[model samples]
Target: MEILERNVEKILAVLSLLAISLIFVYIFKNSDASIINWDEEKVNLNINDKVYENLYIDKINVPPVKAGDVVTITKKDFKLSDNNENLVFRTYGSTIDVFLSGENIYSYGEDLYREGKTLGRGYHIVKLRSLGDKTSDLVIKQRIVEDMSYRWVDFFKFTSSNNIWHEILINNVFGIVSGIFLFSLGAFGNLVYVVLFLITKKNNLHLSYSFATMFFIGLWNCTTSGIIQAITGNYEIISFLEYFSIYATFVMYLFLVALIKKKSGKTKAIDIVKLLSLLILIGATALHLSGTLCISKTIMLFRNYALIVLLVLFYTLYIDYKNQKKYENVLLIGNCISFALIVVHIIIHNFNLTEIMDITNDNLITIAVLVMIIIPLFLYFLELDEIEKYEMQIRVLKSLAYIDKLTGLGNRTSGIAYIMDLIKNGFDYYIVMFDLNNLKEVNDHLGHDKGDEMLVNFANCLNSSFSDDYCKKIRYGGDEFIVVAQFDKVEDINDNIKQLFRVIDEVNRDGEKGYSLSVSYGIASSKEFATTGYENVVKLADERMYSYKSEVKNQICET
Candidate 1:
């Protein structure tokens, strides 16, 4: 009862200390106020001075552990703050067994290995349970199953009640947080884009795919950080996710590239590259899950394959740039950045240079994945803006094709199409053809500008005479205008012509211009000429208009 009460108090104290330490980690990670005693002299696993070397040091040439090597590291009579405190360390691609005084104290990953599975990286927090009073040798035998980027197991200091994840997170919080940010951004962004596409019929699915790729990138980042084991004890599941997300993210990235380049009509290059890389990724995944060959062993191949994809796409982007395609330069810069990082990773891994290594090479990889997802988004927005602008220009050109500039009405082509449409629909309609009385005289006597003004005033009169619901006013040519209207009866057609004459009278009554706007028009109804075509009706209207012109001339002579 007394020991349990003491242990609980110690645990509370350690938790409070870790809480404050986490604040420092977020605010300033290099603060001296640390919860875990990182100093080798006070927090080491060994009571003797021999165990103090390379404890939590960032760069050391500790020998690389190979598969099937059962290396034993023993600590005799290791000092512990209390019986409740636990020993913690990190190992990659290995199984571990701990024996205290020749009795098995803790064992991990053996069952997974027996099942022909790769025991993923583990943050082992071995509990110190033993004869409370006896001092014994703590023997740790680690069997390496695969060679990794960081091959040596690092023994981190002890913490109360298996609370050792804070130390690993403290030094590497930026990459981890960046990973979570990417994951969150991708998840929310994908949901919004997908919903937008489904509901509003907006096609931003390529951006959604890009977001999905970011989601997998974040998953890969979090899974390999070795902090997930502390959060959830499912190392096997996390390990699988770590590798599976790699393949998924890579494939999604390739798919996004193909989607972008597909519109360029030169997709053969990207298609071939994607196909070959896809085949390899699929094969690698099958073998990895089936326990034939682990996916960790195939990362080298895939990364090198990624270089090929980038190289081929580089040529594709160059061609697009030459052709002045939008967003190509942005994507080119992104590809170059990623290509350079991949080169750095390859160089570091090939030479095994610990001098430049920041604990693990995976952090650099997370940045590369971030680059692939984020850079595409910038280009997507640029492309989207350019596409909308192009569409607007097309609409303007189409409008100009059917409109007359001087009269602000439909042109001759529009009148012909409108007349033919009314005839085709079998609608009871009226087609009125009007010719200005003295347009040529106005042009020859008062200059062409006055003639243009008269033409515009008459178009305004036509517009005011009929509502757009069933009327189309067209400036067919100089001094020749057409008005097409649908009406229930010919009486309604006469009423509109009366309105047209009234509007012309109003315009002349204004006395703004020196000349009066006069028009002679002849109307033909579709119902009256069901057998005669629209062209014949228009010809009859033209003949009547000439007769009206003669009547106007005769009345002028009498006046």
Candidate 2:
């Protein structure tokens, strides 16, 4: 029955993990941080022979206004007739129109401009005003009105490329799937650690660091997609969300760096890089929001550079993995290639260069992203098992090297290494050498077993007294020990030695032992050694210990 219960629990755990993984995959695949923007609007105008040869305005800005609002065409600059007949103009979408003949101008809607219609072949600007109670703005688009003799150039048509739309959809779909897979792979490592912690009842929260990193990634993607969806039709909203997500992406990368260098305390470099990327994103966003359409178009060029950074990261990871095969960070490489492909699609669309590769412009990149999500997810699962085995080996090796076999205290080699580190770091410290008063006598009288007990007890006392304090205790030899620590003055060192002696005296007075466990301690400080090496200082401490033992012997003889 107990075995059945355990099996059921295991099944439940597996099911829960699978469910969460699927949900995460769904979120990664379906989310997007892009808004829909309307393609340019086009209208056709008929030109009469009389006024079509005169002054023309190419574009105009018309704000939201109610009916009967007299729209003004501020004699805005216009292009000459395409063939010396009609002029074409791009204008803001308002509910108004302007009549132009030479320098003559009048404002009205579809009616007044009818009079100025002439045998011209060019574009003209017209303002618009609303006819209803509620005022609304229009997205002004270019229109071409033709006359009997209208030139071919005057027959303007604004067409948005369907190819661009297809490319965006395909690239984005692929990207989404791939991204989710990569994320899931990374999460597998954390899941393994979390399960181990649960089974052992140990607070091994190391995996939480990675979890926090991936949680931010998921959060950022979720926030970006929702914002993009909400701002689909609002220009201001779209502009704001674009820059926000771009900056957030950089911040996420910086956070990842922090996770990798857990203890380096060099987070400022990450902050600086994040700040620069944010500035670039903000600057591009601002240029887009301003009236400069060309500058807005230029931002796609900057995005190409960001893609380059992703490539660099991919190669760096590959190099690291070569040196240390343990790091199979597949997401870094998978996402890099996925994003690179998407960028290629973008470039092809922007420049009409589709001959290089069999690139599809129908959500192919989106699908690529989706596919990438699986790479991380599965890779994470594999990495978790490898990491556990590696950590186990490390623990075993460390135990052999640093732990004393007899008493479990720090071993002689570890003690020497610790002191060497302190010396290299220029720490002024005190070394207290402790020797068992009569270990040979105890061994001769009570056999090696009793002597071993005395040694164990002595080691335990050293560990108990100094382990929780400022001192580090080590089993220096068979019947010798040492305590090392940084001290401000010799007086502090003296007080600690006196406390050690008092503890030994108390133990002896209590009886019940074969030869009371007592130690003769010698203290040496860096300050007293002046220019001497650590070896010389240790020798001095040992000599002092013998002198103290001699005094104790004399006192015992008198008694």
Candidate 3:
């Protein structure tokens, strides 16, 4: 049972790799799939039960045709109305033996003259034979013309054989090879790691492996279409398959954008840019499908441009390495190498310089090389020393900027910047201002250390009670804290603060020293001072806080 199951798994894996390889091979083979038009005039028609027709062009450039031959011809749009049967002119290679309706009619030299001429226009399939005892090679071609009678058709001509099909086939083969490698080495490992990571509840590691799998899958598919064209000399199939590969890449690109956006939180501007790029991709695809455009040239450009973007993103990784170093360094290196392989393939394919000697789709195998070799090794080399330096630099800068290290809250400088940004954007938000009571008396009775502890405790309580989504917390000064909530309405701001304060009171009652911490609070809505801006809101909230504090103090004094 185990052996059978293993065999089935192997079969499935091979099939998947084959599928991806075919897709990429198809794309690469049909990079230049546009039709090439050749000019031609009247081809001599020989109706042979036994008849010979000789067709010749003297001065004009025509696709080559000789006497005594059978040819298949096609035009853009022309139909023969004789029984609605499109004409196919046929003749023997050597003998001028012609048969109409399976009955022998005539031979060229014995029964008819070879110099007989018949001219009919639009597109014609003409057969001819030289007036000799020996036979020559058979040639066939398709032609198009405006008017056949006037157009000059020259004598036999030849053209260099097209190698586009050959190149396409080889590319498709390469695609297959690369796909197999990616599936076996990169994606297999990634899949295993993803499943294991998720089972172990390592969400970050799971994310890394999941992304790795997708990236390699895309890589595998993009190259296989090229390999297909390399093997079988079929251009039409290659062109059709290329469309699939491009569509696959479009999907992968979207997935990449979504992954990055998910990590970076909400950024509307970046989302908008990605949306525009997606629209362009869709437009290009639609054009190709409708046969109005062939986007292979554009796709080729995008492959290289995508590499440059990937390189830039790699630098961004280096820039952010410090902050992201705690988990899955291995996955980062894997991603980098996978992207590098794609870049290398583009360089090799575009420049005709990959193998230096023998060229094949196996070059795509380099992605597996990176995943199985480079990434694992890079992970081992990861050190915290550089990251530590970055964090230390950030710490020093934050101290000088607007971080209050004692309570871990934003200080005056950063607080002002945050509020000013909201005001510049012309948003409606609420400002809540508050101050701790009885600090001086507590400091005198229990020393400055106890007073400092009380202040830190109060900051911690506010931090825990308030969420950053709706409110931005700030240490306004000693014994004072402020929160600016950005939103559309004042009631939401008021209700949220009331709920947060109730939670804080509960937390205080749970116990802390002999005395419970208390504060007087006030709120100012953005609507109340739309013309006055953020500074006015701050001033108004502070004034309300002072008034509330005085009233509470008066109540205490009366008691």
Error of 3 at 202 (Å): 27
- Cα RMSDs, all models: 12.1, 14.4, 16.7
Better of 1 and 2 by lDDT: 1
Instruction: Assess each prediction's global lDDT (C-alpha) against the native.
Output: 0.70, 0.49, 0.50
After superposition, candidate 2 runs with Cα above 4 Å error: 1-392, 489-491, 505-513, 557-559
Clashing pairs in 1: none
| Cα lDDT over the full model 3 | 0.50
Candidate 1 lands at a TM-score of 0.67
Q: Give the candidate order by descending TM-score.
A: 1, 2, 3
Model 3 regions more than 4 Å off: 1-403, 487-514
Task: Write candidate 1's Cα lDDT for 313-337 as tens digits.
Answer: 7788777876646556778778888
